[model samples]
Target chain A: MITVRCFATVREILGCETRTLPPSSTPQLASDILRIVAGARTTDLPKPLLVAINCEHASLTSPVKDGDEIAFFPPVSGG
Target chain B: MIIRLQTADFDPEREAQALDVKGAGARVSFVGTVRDTAQDRRIEALEIEHYPEMTRAELARIGTAAQTTHDLLEVLIIHRYGRLQSHERIVLVTVWSAHRAGAFAGCQAIVDALKTRAPFWKKEISPEGAVWVPGQTPQDLR
Candidate 1:
């Protein structure tokens, strides 16, 4: 299984902190999980969101393995 | 070499005193504070979030890169997390060098690299609404 984590606005929108997907799931990149979560959302997901795999910022095409942990975060407004 | 991820506010005087030591002729410091307004919109507060491990690693990498690119003596970076109000200091970057030019260049380069590469995130809360700062992409790297 792969663990998917959401943060910031995405977490608020999804209302779930973490979810697990089957290892055989298709579209296994960090961005793919976003598309999946966004698809399930009632509202449109915000643009310019960021994705990370195993605590490292990752591109949309970055591959994910079984048991990988992924996180999504929106742009930072901090100083 | 000091790195801190803290929730408590920091004092510039304390940081300067701690980083200042023998062999350093110049010291450059940059403090980023939460502004009361952004683009004319009044901000009430800011909620900062970060991928913990990633943020630390990224900041350290930036510090190391700065040291390599410039002649420097020391570097210290401290950032606060959690809720922060307007006009409060959010981040502090300190660099010490033998010359003013090195100190200035090194400090600027470290901050710039952190902005572009660090995984820390921020969300502004205002009376009007909340907005996230746009994420920096690879193209933003200098």
Candidate 2:
């Protein structure tokens, strides 16, 4: 199993802190997870949201192993 | 070995104090503050968002990577969440190394990695509307 975390606007929009998905899920990579979460939160998923796995930015094809942690967030403006 | 995600204000001195290690000769620090203007828009405030578990893990991983790449002794990273006004310190990074170059390089790498890697996002609230800024590119994220 993998733990999915939503943050910032994504968290507020989703109304949950974390969600657990089976090892085999759609959009398996961390980026894909963001897409799924974004889709679930807003009627139309924003194109610019960011995704990270284990604190490192990951592409949509980055494979996620079992017990891996994933986080999804929008763009950042902090210095 | 300290990682924090808080909405409360942070003290760089205190954060620096935490980086005290026996073997390190130099300590380099980086503070990320909230800027007033973004994309030429008169800024008001910033809303910072991050994933909890994933953020911590990602930061730790980045710290580890920095340690591996550079001859660093210790590292400290602090990131704030929630509403923040302009000029507020949003993130703090401290690195201890045997030499200044290592510390500086490690610190820079950490901050750069954080920008592109960490699951943190920011939204600028201005007179016009709220817009999400594009994050680091995939190459930059790495």
Candidate 3:
């Protein structure tokens, strides 16, 4: 299973912090899971989300594998 | 170079004194504090979230980038997370180099990089309610 993590606004929007999705025979990209979250949130894919695969910056086109931790959130606001 | 991510508030003076000061012609230190207000609303505190491994990775990357881009002698970074009150220091960045220009430029780069690259989310707490700080790109920060 691939674990998905959401933070900040995305977590609040979905009312969930984590969701484990069953790995599919076909390769799953980060955007695919993001689509699911947006659907669950009852929103039309709000704004662009910043993605990280296993804690590293990744794009929507990045691939996902079983046991991988994918996090989605808004752009950073830190210093 | 040094990097520290902690929830405990740090003493900037103590940290500054701990660094090697000899052989450096210039030093620049920056401390970021939580403002009491944002968007005309009073902010009582901020709750911060971060990805542990990711925070370390990105901070290291920013440190290295600042060093190479600005040619610095030393670099230091400290960031705090968790519930924190207004006026509390949120981060500390220090840069040392043979010249003031490099120190200034390197420190700026390090700060800017941290704001955008670091995987940290903050929420603003006030009388109204706790609200997530709106996110923006690095360019928009300025």
Candidate 4:
């Protein structure tokens, strides 16, 4: 199982904080999981989006596997 | 080093007093507050959202980086989430070092890195409506 999470503006765009997907046999990348989770709203996501796998920063090309929690978020704006 | 994320407001004076500043020759504290206006629009409040574990880890990373880079003796970072009214403190970074220069640099480094690195977002609640503040990329990242 892979759990996908969204934060900040990305959360607002995705309309959900977390979603868990069933296990997949085929090899999947971060982009694939993001595309699968985002569905048709992929283009609506905020620009310069960031990805994290298992709580560490990652890129779209990063691999995804069962038990990994992937996160998509807008660039951080904090102080 | 100390790091905290809380919904309750903090008293900087109390926090400073609690720290063991005995050995340090210099101590610097920075407090970030919610502004009454954002981008020319008057705001009623600022809503801060942060990823639970990720935010903590990132803040720790920033604090450690500052400590190493600036030779800081001690560091403290306190960030608040949820809705905060104008003028309310949003974050606090305090550093102690053998000299003023290290303390100053360490505090600034933490603040600068936290602005772009920490996984926190601010939304402006205005009379018009709520809007997510736009994201900013550090010059080096671009």
Candidate 5:
């Protein structure tokens, strides 16, 4: 299973805070996971949406593995 | 190095005085407070959200990098999250060093890095509505 989390506006738009996806067709990368989560709402995602794997800031192309945690969110604005 | 991610407010004077300074001849501190307005909109509050584990790690990275680049004695970073009213304190950064230059530069470097590198999101609640700040990490870091 791949653990997926969303935060900030992304969470608000998706209406989901967390989700679990069983490995199917092997979603091999962070972008793949995003595609699944986005579904038909691709256009709603942030233009420069951010991704993180296992709590470290990462890119969409970062590889994914079973049981890994993935996060999607808008750009950070904190100081 | 000391890093704190808390929902409670902190006193800058108390935090600065609490640092264990030995040979430090200078101490520099920075406090960030929420503004009452953004652009022309009257801001009501700021809602801050963060990835817990990542926030700490990124802060540590920034603190350590600042220390590496300067001659420092101590580093302390306190960042508050959750709903905050306008004019409330949002963050504090303090650094102690042997000279004024190192202390000043180190503190500035930490604050600059924190602004872009930390995994924190802020939403401004104004009279109009709540909106997320459209800031992102640089392309290389993302």
Candidate 6:
């Protein structure tokens, strides 16, 4: 299973924090996972999400294997 | 020299004093606080969220990059996550160098880098509602 973590507005829009993807799609790319969930509320997700795999920043094209943890959030605004 | 992310507030003066450089003559420090207003709304608080390990990694990268650009003796960055009320400090950047030019530039570069590169995102809480700053509103995105 792949665990997808959402934050901030994406959390509010999806109404869920974590999504577990079954092993059938054992090795989906990060962008593909985002596409699947982005359908729930297409417009609500951040235009460009900052993604990370296992606490390390990653691009959407990054590979995701079963049991990997992924996170998505809006771009940083802190100073 | 030091970069940290914490939920608790920090004492800027105490932090500045902590960076002891024997021969470093110039030091510049920057402190950023939550504003009382944003998008013309009276902000009540700021709720910051960040990637745990990634935030640390990015901050360190920015600090190191700033250090490389100048003759810096030391650099410190402290950023806070979680809920913060208006006027509460959010981040601190301190740079120590042999000369004022390097110190000033280093401090500014670090702060600028933090604003864009760090993994932290803030949502402004006001009477209207909470909205992520510098981000498209849910309705707008819809």
lDDT of 1 by residue, B49-75 (tens): 876777787788878889888877899
Ranking by TM-score: 4, 5, 3, 6, 1, 2
Please tell me which model should have the higher lDDT, number 2 or number 6. Answer: 6
DockQ, all models? 0.39, 0.38, 0.61, 0.75, 0.71, 0.50
Segments in model 3 whose C-alpha atoms lie over 4 Å from true places: A42-46, B138-142
Single out the weakest 10-residue window by summed lDDT for candidate 1 chain B.
Answer: B133-142
* CAPRI class assigned to model 5: medium
lDDT of 5 by residue, B87-120 (tens): 9999999999999999999999998888787888
Tens-digit lDDT track for model 4 on A1-79?
8999999878888898999998789999999998888889999998787888888778888899999999999988888
| Model 6 ranges with Cα > 4 A deviation | A20-27, A66-68, B135-142
Best by DockQ: 4
lDDT of 4 by residue, B20-69 (tens): 86679999999999999877999899999999889888888889989999
By DockQ, the better pick of 2 and 4 is: 4
What TM-score do all the candidates reach, one by one? 0.84, 0.76, 0.90, 0.95, 0.94, 0.85
* TM value for model 3: 0.90
Residue pairs clashing in model 2 are A54-B58, A55-B58, A75-B122, A76-B122
Per-structure clash totals for the candidates = 2, 4, 0, 0, 0, 1
Model 3, residue B88: C-alpha shift (Å): 0.8
**Cα lDDT of model 2 by residue, B1-142, tens digit:** 6788999999998879855598888998898888799879977888877666667887898899999899888888989988888888899999998899999999999898787667667888889988765665445543
Candidate 3 vs candidate 6, DockQ winner: 3
lDDT of 3 by residue, B73-137 (tens): 89989999999999999999999999999999999999988888898889999999998887654
Tens-digit lDDT string for candidate 5 (A1-79): 8999998888999998999999766549888888999888967988788888888788989998888899998887767
RMSD (Cα, Å) of model 2: 4.0
DockQ of prediction 3: 0.61
- Give candidate 4 regions above 4 Å deviation: B138-141
The DockQ-based order of candidates, best leading, equals 4, 5, 3, 6, 1, 2
